[model samples]
Target chain A: MEKAGIPVVQITAVTPVARMVGSNRVIQGHGIVHPLGDADLPPEEEKELRRQLVQQALEALKREVKS
Target chain B: MRVVHYLNQFFGGVGGEEKAGTSLEVHSGALGPGRVLEQALGEGFQVVQTLVCGDNYAVENMDELSVRVLEMVRSAKADLFVAGPCFNAGRYGVAAGALCAAVQAELGIPAVTAMVPENPGVDLYRQELYIVDSGSNVAAMRDVVARMAHISLKLVRQEPIGRPSEEGYISRGILRDELVERTAAARMADMVLAKANEEPFESELPVTVFPPVPAPPPVRDMSRAIIAVVTDGGLVPLGNPDHIPLSAATIWGSYSVAGIDNLEGGNYEVAHRGYDTRHVLEDPNRLVPLDVLRELERAGVIGKLYEEFLSTSGLGNPLGNSRRLGREMAQKLKGVVDAVILTST
Candidate 1:
């Protein structure tokens, strides 16, 4: 889909499968049940954690230049 | 040369689809199509025995049945193996192709089979076995058997099989090495120069397929680009006013967190039917991190969030549906959203 001019980043628990399937950019997640959150972490901690991950996604969107 | 032949129940004349669960039974002589095939083999090779099994039973028990079939063929000590010109019968074609491939691998025998080009078997076994072109159904049986017999004889004698078009067989995507007057570098140069001159030239190599999607050029500035978050996580407001199905959902609803700082638990729910939604219902953030995206927005890390988020639940999705949905969603965001983060569960 990215080849058509849209930039796409995938966040997945199955990082290997994402890589293998040729997902352009991928961010690893903790578990299949909840991709972006740690149920055990406090709200602030979870927010900070997700912030870093989202930040990666944002940076990934900007720098991935392969056509 | 001795040859072992394979057949499914109906082709073996044991019974119709009703007997598709029948056990493996070996007959000492040609049965049904094999009789004609044996005749076509002429005096040089003989159809020593016919191996029969149910199509349903063969595919359903592929590993066990293939091992058994190999044992039966091995004991025959056949120089070659032949299976059905199963025509358009899907199950029977699969059985014929599979058994032929197994025979070649297990007994080290030259094996050949025939089936319609559209047969699933052609795709699976064409590379391993020289699959002669056959008719869609039994009406082309005689012509098919003749071609198969001719190919089998060539294989039995260890003669080189020609290209798929020349030999009347489906391409297994095999590249045959042949002596050519043109050198490799010369041929490549000719191809390039001809194309540059707007002349037609056939590619020497098969098309390179399944190339990975290249990543697009990265965003030059994050603080000024509109980033959108999309999910297959099935996010929805508390009541799920859009009624996106809990599973296999194609309906994605965009609720306003536009003004909200963080998604409060109980205000949102995960409508996905794939996983236990217990944890997600307590906090939808687990599936889609709107809370964190909101934080990013406040910190000016991103220019702006595309006001409406996109989502659907596809924990178990067909490839066709996934592709279609992707196109549809992408179309919606084409000119509006600058970048996408697609979250998959």
Candidate 2:
């Protein structure tokens, strides 16, 4: 997708793996199974976590990427 | 020994690009490079038949053509099958590899084909056939043919085949159980010693190095940018409406989130088997975060969310498959989506 001129923010718990695979914008997620929402958290808190992660992804989109 | 050869239009003495649409044709004896191949295979081996097809037609109708080619090979009673020293010809390499694999599998004939390492067919069919590395130079046809014939002879005789480097073939990634003088630990120590001494050493295991992808420029205006959420987390509608596989998926689906605000648990399910999907099953938002994205969309944090979520399963996914799908998704999202939030498990 990056090669197609669209910046992509990959949300995964395995940030290093993402970077190694050439994902430019990577945001650390909560876990492997549930990248956005945490299962252990209460529903409201989980939503908050997801919100924060999404916001971070947006922030990642706004920034410049250095090689 | 009766050997059958496959060739593309140009090599088959047919006109070049103009003849690329010509269908399959069978001819007697060796034609063009097949004579070289027959000679390489030695006096006992005769090129009994040659199958020629246009590269475009062969690739465009690979499945049907393969079936027909297999039937022809079966009837020909060929002892060995040889397809091009195709080198870097993409379509020809694919057709050759496919036919070689089919003949070997169906007719119980030893089959050999050759291609350059970068030919797409090398990656697609190297595991199934002995693809001699022809090194992208048509001038080296005799060398490539000799290697292919050598490997084919060994295969026909049920001999233990040599490694890719020794045989001049692309690696099939099959590990052989060999009795060596050095233990793994010893080899590892030697490799470490070599590295420490700034000397060159070949590692036993070859790592697949992905070509670096240049980062696309960041979205200029966040408030007006249209964003799409895509996932390899395998979230799908209940019953897997698009039938996305649980692992090594070849298909992706775009589920309509047009009027929907948040993804409901019962209406959606996880199609991936790589992880414990119980959390995602209970609340699909855990995987895709549609709820949070919806909130952001409404709050004008972004211009809009792409109405559909692009999804595919990533379990046991190969890099080739992922790259193909990513390119397809990129093509689909080119004009509309400004950025993407790709969730992976």
Candidate 3:
């Protein structure tokens, strides 16, 4: 995409697989169910899970190429 | 002398199938079925407080129950927490398991529970806490409570409790040291001899070391680099979802977003079965947040992000999958991107 003038980022609850498949940019999440949190659980838990995942995603974007 | 006892609704004398809907409550005395614990502990150990919460209440309200139980134990001055001989009741077993885990975590006190091997709770909580194997029915109450109390006493007194094998409890994932009768030199010699002769030998010593794998060759330059973003979280389309089987996903697919700003609804979703796909499907951004990466690319932080995103299901996927995926992805991205950033949840 970059060669064609497009920017891309990939987000997933599981970043290991993303890295394995070779995404340009990647993000991590909390769990399999409710990468954020399920509605059955309290709202606070969901928010915290989402916040952590978002923080990790932003950090992935900031990472400089070290190759 | 201070101890806490945990019991399900039936054991707490809250009535059988008739009163299964009973609410959780903490009592100070030997209420309901606590008499068994009281008698087993004898005079030295006292059941200072009894926590009689229903099985459904604890599992359904884990956060609140954890908080409330922690507070109760803190005020009760408990030196140890003992849970139920849950028999075959699955929910009751899980509740006891959760309570024991919470008590150990919050109070830093030793906790013990008894459950039948077939109980689902045994599998989930055994690794987290000590769960002694018990009979499948309530007929084993006397033996179960007595054994649990004996172990609880040893824990409270800081005594050297025997190994899980000898003490008849499930293994707690703790590597316990056992002093065998054989000398170290003799054991090593026997092991080497057995290995040479192709005979079974008991090893008294274990070596803890892992050889490191060679590192990948460094990329030449960043100015003209090809970057690829790979995900194993099974993100795909909802309609004809690209289902990546859990633990054994051999194939991976790439989705094209040539001119799109962000992955919109019906455009991308997760195909991984190991994790729930609702959140990521509801907001595809959760699985692939192109907004932030686009900004980075525009700022020249990276030369250019890869055109396609590689994806597969990662849950329980063996190491072979990792090797295959890494090699395949690396081959595709090597000429295009300077570096790759691998992410796992």
Candidate 4:
């Protein structure tokens, strides 16, 4: 939709899964349980997994060209 | 001509169950049961060296054992390698069979072994190496060793040995010479007659299936587009707590992300069947990385991201179901997303 001039956003739980599912745009997250963050696990681990997942998602949004 | 012989701990005079942990060692001259092979082969063939390893040792460490055995064969300068008349002992039979196969594959040697038909190894390695049928217990030792030695002699001498069945060994299923019993025309006529009579007829050929391809949809204007991202990867609720069947997935569910920034933890999960779900379950971001797409959206890489992410389990699902699911998903997202990306596990 973005390629043709529409606004869009993508969210995902796992970085590897997203890579395999390759998209012109993407978002990264910590995991599948709590894509943003599960209340479980050490706050750091959850925060890291979530931070990475969200970071990938944000990067996916910036791709202006779709190849 | 030099020959190498392999034997189990018991046959090598290394004791019984107590010696099961014995390691491999090379000894010159006939040792234990190897003496039988030496006498059977006569003065023309010398059992130059005997390589013995416990059956358990070989089975538990196949790679290491094979390397040691191969090194022994190379150093012994043996022209022929013969393994056990393993009888019905499963581990021993398997070890002997495996060693023979490894020797043949690595050194291009004509290797031989013997086993009772009931030994599981007979069925497993029969096609890969030469295996002679023998009595089910050690009592058949003399006869089995003699037969194996005889076959090895012929192989070493490069003499003409008959087919496996004629030579009293298990059939290796290798078609060496195709002897035509009847002409092609005669066989075709017999086949047609059998078919006409409604009798079961085996065709000399196979039938091929060529399915018709569906026509592609008309191209849409690139300017005004509604693109969708669809996947059969089964991304769903974190609780998946939905418990979608793994292999035979027949259901599909869509999670609505309308008015949402991105898929959040506890909100989404992966239902893909082909891989370990632990990682993706712990963090749903693994399956659908919405954060990256959100960033791309901010940068204006594309116009819009589809509101709902489509998902289904892809593991072992029939091609028919996949095709139907693909077409249905495409139809549903047709006007919503101008172009689409489909992901598989």
Candidate 3 lDDT over residue span B6-117, tens digit each? 7777888776766666677788866544678778888867788888877766677878877888898889888888888888898888888888898998789999999887
Q: Higher DockQ: candidate 1 or 3? A: 1
Residues B1-345 of candidate 1 have per-residue lDDT tens digits of 888899989989889989999988899978888889989998866778998898888889988988988888888888988888788888888888888888888788888888887776875677677888887767778888998888888887789877777778877776666799989999999999999999988786755234466677777778877888788888888788888887766666666657876667778777787876676777777777777777677788888888877877876664445656777788788878778988877
Candidate 2, B1-345: lDDT as tens digits: 999899999999997999999999999899999999888889799999999999999999999999989988888889989999898999999899889988888888899999988787886788888999898779988888889889989998899888888777888888888889988999999999999999998889999876677889998888888899899999999999989999999989988899898888899888899999988888888888888888888899998999889999988887778877888999899988999999998
TM-score to native of every candidate shown: 0.50, 0.80, 0.49, 0.46
DockQ of 3: 0.07
If both were scored by lDDT, which would come out higher, candidate 2 or candidate 4?
2
Model 1 segments beyond 4 Å from truth? A1-67, B181-345
Task: Provide the lowest-lDDT 10-residue window in model 4 chain B.
Answer: B208-217
Model 4: residues with Cα > 4 Å off, grouped in runs: A1-67, B180-345
- Candidate scoring better on DockQ of 2 and 4: 2
Clash pairs (backbone) in predicted model 1: A61-B219, A62-B218, A62-B219, A63-B218, A64-B216, A64-B217, A64-B218, A65-B217
Top-lDDT candidate index: 2
Cα displacement (Å) at residue B180, model 2: 2.5
TM-score between candidate 4 and the true structure: 0.46
- Name the top DockQ candidate: 2
Q: Which docking band does candidate 4 fall into?
A: incorrect
- Model 3 alpha-carbon miss at residue A49, Å: 41
DockQ of each: 0.43, 0.79, 0.07, 0.04
TM-score of chain A of 3: 0.59
Best by TM-score: 2
